[model samples]
Target: MSLEIAISIVMTLVIAATPILLAGLGELVAEKSGVLNLGVEGMMLVGAVAGFITASLTGFTPAGYAVAALAGLCASLLFGVLALTIGANQVATGLALTIFGTGLSSLAGAGFVGTTITRLPALFPQGLAGHPIFRIVFGYDVIVYLSVALTLAAAWFLNHTRPGLILRCVGESDASAHAIGYPVTVIRYLAVAFGGALAGLAGAYYSLAVTPMWADRITAGRGWIALALVVFSSWRPWRLLLGAYIFGAVMTLELYSKAAGFALLPPEMLAMLPYLATVVALAVIAMRPSRGRLDAPRCLGKTFRAGA
Candidate 1:
């Protein structure tokens, strides 16, 4: 490929990876605190629609993102109440949250179908952001950079901070954490809310930056891909960034192949590439030795009861 083509491809890859990276980071934090939320897909959809609607009406992308994060936060809190407070099965509650988010987003967005909005602008000045060579490094919007920063922050917080150690303790042994006077349920609620907010912002990236338009399920299952990415990364933030980019490359294949007029595979099959990668990655992880899977938090998906 020509240098320009390579640059274009790399730029596309970054855009494709940003949402997954953001959502994966959020999920990683939650899992570190011992909560397993499977409704990431739903949260993304809700955020996408909410962001699109807000931006469409107000002509401001930032407001849209803020609203999207709040929407996701609300959805997650519902899950926390059911799973943590009411003692519902975590897996079941997560699934229900996904279903509810899907329906809620679709219903709320019904009137906004086919709408268009201004794409988010790049963060740097046009001279830098639009330059042929420099654009490679400076052309992206704030969220792309924010995703990387969040990765570094997450890694540091998990390994270097006192609260981080406490969170890990809760994940490994919530009963022990509770016995030590930690508020297990409260910590998890905050983690879940954080996850939901990021998931929402990731969804907004789809509507505001990737496509600049609204449609049903605009995220196209990227949320599930992000969930799988968390596992594929062994719950490590740095690995999650790497995994998101790898998946991004897989997803970018569909667009590049279509543009390059490669007809060896049908368009339908091309579209399946990312999801196929997700399944394959998950299978590979599952087949690893039991010890390899021990990187996951010990109390993952377990409901914590204070007195039990």
Candidate 2:
């Protein structure tokens, strides 16, 4: 690729990865709290639909994002109630939530599939827009800023703050947390909801800024890929950023290649590149032995109760 092409690719990657990073990091936080929310894909779909509809009508991408996040938070509440409070099977609830989100999104956004959104206001000054380093890294939408800030905050929360320590305690051993008078179920519930909001925001980014339109499966199982990224990152926030950006770059490259006239592969193959890479990467990681899990919370995916 030429310098300009390479730079353009990098820019697309950052934009594409913004949502995944946000969603995955949020999930990292939720799972670290011992709640396995498999409904990220569902939450994202709903967010996409919700964000698209809101922005199309209001012409305010920010407001659309807020609505999307709210929708995601509300959708996640069901998962929280089932998995955390009622102690339902986490995997099953996640799948159900996915179905629920998909159905709801399709129904709600039936009228928005081919729509378009205006470009978001640039973050940096016009002079910075063409700057090599500044434009690619710092010049992003407000939500992009939120994603980075949240990742750092999550890192600090898990390592430095008292609440962070306590949240970790709940994730590591809910019974232990309860023994120390922490509201185990309540904490997990809140974590799940926060996670949902983040995922929603990610989805909204897709509708309002990235793809800027409504399309069924626009997320294309990005939720599952993000889930794998969490595992790929071994639960670390910074690694989540790395994994997300890399994945996003790969995804954008596939599209760019097809658009640039590569005849070697089928157009469908190009579209499949990102997901195929995610699967292969995860499989390789699964086969590894010494990558030692550094950021994994102690009791991720286990159901906890007040008296159990």
Candidate 3:
């Protein structure tokens, strides 16, 4: 490939990876706090529709992002109430959230189909930002930058901060945490809410930053991929960033293949490569007895009861 083409590919990879990294970081935080939230897909869909509608109505991308984050946070809280408060199964609740998100986004976005909007403008001035080659480094909107910052912050908070240690304590042994006078449920609620917010932001980035339009199920299973990414990273923020970029490259390759009219592989099968890659990676990870199941927090997926 030409240098220009390589640059284009690299830029596209960064764009594709940002949302996954954002959502994965959020999920990583929640899981570290001993909560398994599977409704990221649903929350992302809700955020997409909510952001699109809000931006379309008000013509303000920032406001739309705020609404999207709020929408995701609310969706996550719903999961928290069911799974944490009422003691519902985390996996089942997460599945229900995804279903609800699919239906809700579709219903809300029905009127906005086929419409498009101007992309979010770049932050830097046009001189450097307009350069075809240089734009790769300076061209992206705020969300892209925010993804990197969040990744760094998550790493710092998880390893360097006192509250971070406490959060890890809760995840490691909630019963012990509770015995030590920590409010296990409250901490978990915060973690889930934070995760939902980032997931919503990721979904919003789809409408406002990536495509800038409304569509049914616009997230296209990226949320589930993000969930898998958390596991693929062994619950580490830095690894999550690396994993997101790797998956992003795979996704970009699929698009490039289609555009190049490469007829060797069927289009349908080509489309499946990213998902297939995820499954195979997960399977390989699972088969590793030392790393697969035990890498996650010990209290993950377990219902925490204060009285028990």
Candidate 4:
């Protein structure tokens, strides 16, 4: 490929990776606090529709992202209440959240179907962001840059901060943390909320940036892929970023293949490539020794109660 073509592919790959990176970061934080939320897909859909609706009505793209994050926060709080407060099965509650979110987003977004909105603008001015080569570094929207920043921030927070140490303690031994007078449940609630908000913002990226339109299930199961990404990264923030880009590269192939009219593979097969890669990568990870699994937070998915 020529330089321009390579640049274009790289740009597309970065854009494709941003949502997953955002969602994976959020999930990584949540899991670090010992909560397993499987409803990421649902939270993303809710955020996507909420963001699209807000932007459509108000003609402001940022408002959509804000509302989307709030929507996701609400959905996650519901999960927190059920799983943490009521002592419901974490796995089951997460699945229910997904179903709830999917239905709610579809219902809420029905009227907005086929509607289009202005895509998010680049963060830098045209003078800087418009240059062909420099644009490669400067042409992205705010969220693209935000994803990378969040990755660095997350890594730093988890390793360098005192609160980060506490959060890790809670994940490894909620009972011990509770014994030490830490409010385990409260910490977990915050973690879940954070995950939900990011998942929502990630969803908004789909509606506001990727397609600039609303449709049923606009995320196309990227949320699940994000969840898998958390595992694929061994719960490390930097690894999550790398994994998201790798997956992004895989997803970008479908678009490039279709554009190039590569007839060797059916369009349907091409579409399956990303998900296929996800499954294959996961299988390979599972078949390896327990090192990666060992990296998982010890108390992940366990229901916690103050006196239990």
Global lDDT of each candidate: 0.89, 0.84, 0.89, 0.91
In model 2, residue pairs whose N, Cα or C atoms come closer than 3 Å (at least 3 residues apart or on different chains), thus clashing, are none
Candidate 3 regions with alpha-carbon error over 4 angstroms? 261-269, 275-293
TM-score of 4: 0.93
Which of 1 and 3 is ahead in TM-score? 1
Predict model 3's lDDT versus the native: 0.89
Clashes of 4: 0
After superposition on all C-alphas, the RMSD of every candidate to the true structure, in Å, is 2.0, 2.7, 2.1, 2.1
TM-score of each: 0.93, 0.89, 0.93, 0.93
- Which is the leading candidate under lDDT? 4
Tell me the tens digit of each residue's lDDT in model 2 across 27-111.
9889989888999999999988998898899987778999999999999998988887788899999999999999999899888
TM-score of candidate 1 versus the correct structure, residues matched by position? 0.93
> Per-residue lDDT for 1-308 in model 3, tens only?
67788788888999999999999999999999999999999999999999999988888888899999999999999999999999899989989999999999999999999887666777778876778889888888888988999999999999999999999999999999999999999999999999999999999999888888998999999898899889888888998999999989877876776677765567687667656766776787789877657378999989999979
**Residue-by-residue lDDT tens digits, candidate 1, 25-44:** 99999999999999998999
Q: Hey, what RMSD does candidate 4 come out at?
A: 2.1
Judged by whole-model lDDT over C-alpha atoms, candidate 1 comes out at 0.89
Model 3 root mean square deviation, Cα atoms: 2.1
lDDT of 4 by residue, 196-284 (tens): 99999999999999999999999989898899889878788998999899888876766776677665567787666656765776777
